[model samples]
Target: MKTPVIHLDVDRLIQRIALFALAGLLTIGLSVLGFHHWQMSDPYVRAVLEIEGDVSHGRAIFQMNCAGCHGDSGDGLVGPSLHSISAHKTRASLIRQVIGGQTPPMPQFQPSPETMADLLEYLETL
Candidate 1:
């Protein structure tokens, strides 16, 4: 009777584990440095109202509700371009439009006051 011997490749296994570790570290470093990109805001959620808001949440809300009509960068689409809305219209007006609703083809949004203000902050950045 004969027994076959099995050998383990320890060096190759170590190299593979090291490669994975390096990849993980690189990913963490890139994320910390914001190599991830596409983040809407990072300036500590700058709010401009008496109330408070988060720029990140506002950006998400805008993408979901506004971008379809207003364009991603506010360059305008079905709705008017909002790049300079702050300069053209007052903050109150913007809030009103968001809460109350505009003319035909423009539906009203029921976002909270905080959401509205956050959205305004994001628009200002535009």
Candidate 2:
């Protein structure tokens, strides 16, 4: 009786590993680039970031638009408390959240770039 033999190609195995590593690195690099581009592509984001904000004006805007849900002081009513919100969310993230309204019961808010900047400034104080 003859025993069966198996062969392994060491060079081929090394090539495969290297190819996979290269592919993984390319994927990560592309993802990072794409994210950065996506953030910069929004005109509102760019405009808001460029302008300085007015906290008083922002407070007024909040009182008019958000007080019903978020409370006059942003202490949370129907909506969640905004205290320390800046600590948890980045400015850009806050912008997206306000505009996206992905969460149920929270309507999408499309403020102008200057108004958004003002709101962001006020949120930081909460």
Clashing pairs in 1: none
lDDT of 2 by residue, 13-94 (tens): 9999999999999999999888878987898888898999999999998998888999999999999999999999878888
- The estimated TM-scores of all candidates read 0.57, 0.72
Best by TM-score: 2
lDDT of 1 by residue, 1-126 (tens): 889888989999999999999999999998866732422242222233455657787888889999999898889899888887888766655665676676658897866567877787787777
What would the TM-score be for candidate 1 when compared with the true structure? 0.57
Model 1, position 94, has a per-residue lDDT of 64
Question: Relative to the true structure, how large is the alpha-carbon lDDT of every model?
Answer: 0.72, 0.91
In angstroms, how far off is 118's CA in candidate 1?
1.1
Off by over 4 Å in 2: 1-36
CA lDDT, candidate 2, residue 83 = 93
